[model samples]
Target: MTTPPFPAPTTAELAVVSAQLGRTARGVVGIAARCECGNPTVVATTPRLPDGTPFPTFYYLTHPAATAAMSTLEATQVMPELSALLAEDDGVAAAYLAAHEAYLADRAQFGEVSEIDGISAGGMPSRVKCLHALAGHALAAGPGVNPIGDAALERSTWSPEKCRCDDPGAALRDVEASTA
Candidate 1:
């Protein structure tokens, strides 16, 4: 079994996360990142869930605002542009590979799941697949650890330095209205 990176999550933290996700947040072990208002922005989930499922996503973005921002970027086709950058810039490609390795290392600290081995979320070490996952890693690991994640965050409307935790659903509502 993988040991959690930190202590178990508090009830309040889990509640906030559930509210942000609009569902019961499962397999969450610790608060990886928090909003300025102390709400969970990114959660560190277990590699293996309670149901004997092999899960891959270690850092999960739980903040509604961050999720919405990443979704907006994906909707606007930012992934292709990031993929092109990976293809064109050897430095970024190398950094991305390092980021992938770092992600694997972080997960290893908890435990390893063979089914999800070598698989870091957001298509790490290659193309960008999910900005939410990447942004989660960026928030959890901090800036400069995940270059693509940092880039995505740079292009996002959300800012971690700011606190929008007061109304978790507000950002999602805004995203819905904008998309509508």
Candidate 2:
């Protein structure tokens, strides 16, 4: 009997697997930090498992200073929008609004308090990178419709091309064509 050929892994599959392995390895390293108050700081490295599954593990330590800072940041950046969204009547709209609000909150909180410990893409800190990753996951996993027409707003409203139509009917035709 002939042996069946194994299927090659796709780029996305390889990425997920690699990420899972990295997270597992980091977990095994027991990543932890020390706080000024003689307390152990929580050092969590959330890595996805193969097939894009999130690891059910989180490293926990008590860093009162870090926890306090994180709490203050969350209250300032994430609470108001969440409050507004909670008051909204439309479930879908509320969810979308909340997601954007949460993204903004995380961005603000992490951007202000976290420092980039090592070299990163776009000169952003590892915390900010992690926030971005979380935001991406939230966007992909959340049950909300993305609003359209936002990308179009980024470009210039008018083009510099000249129009050459003297007749009223021709101008109307041009308008119709352009509109269409």
All candidates: CA RMSD (Å): 6.7, 21.9
In model 2, the worst 10-residue window by lDDT is 147-156
TM-score of 2: 0.23
lDDT of 1 by residue, 58-136 (tens): 9999888889999999999999999999899999999999999988998888788999989999998888899999999
Q: What are the TM-scores, per candidate, against the unseen true structure?
A: 0.88, 0.23
lDDT of 2 by residue, 77-138 (tens): 54343334334536534444544444333233222222322222111211111222222223
The TM-score leader among the candidates is 1
In order, candidate lDDTs are: 0.85, 0.29
Tell me the lDDT of model 2 at 21. 37
TM-score of model 1 (CA atoms): 0.88
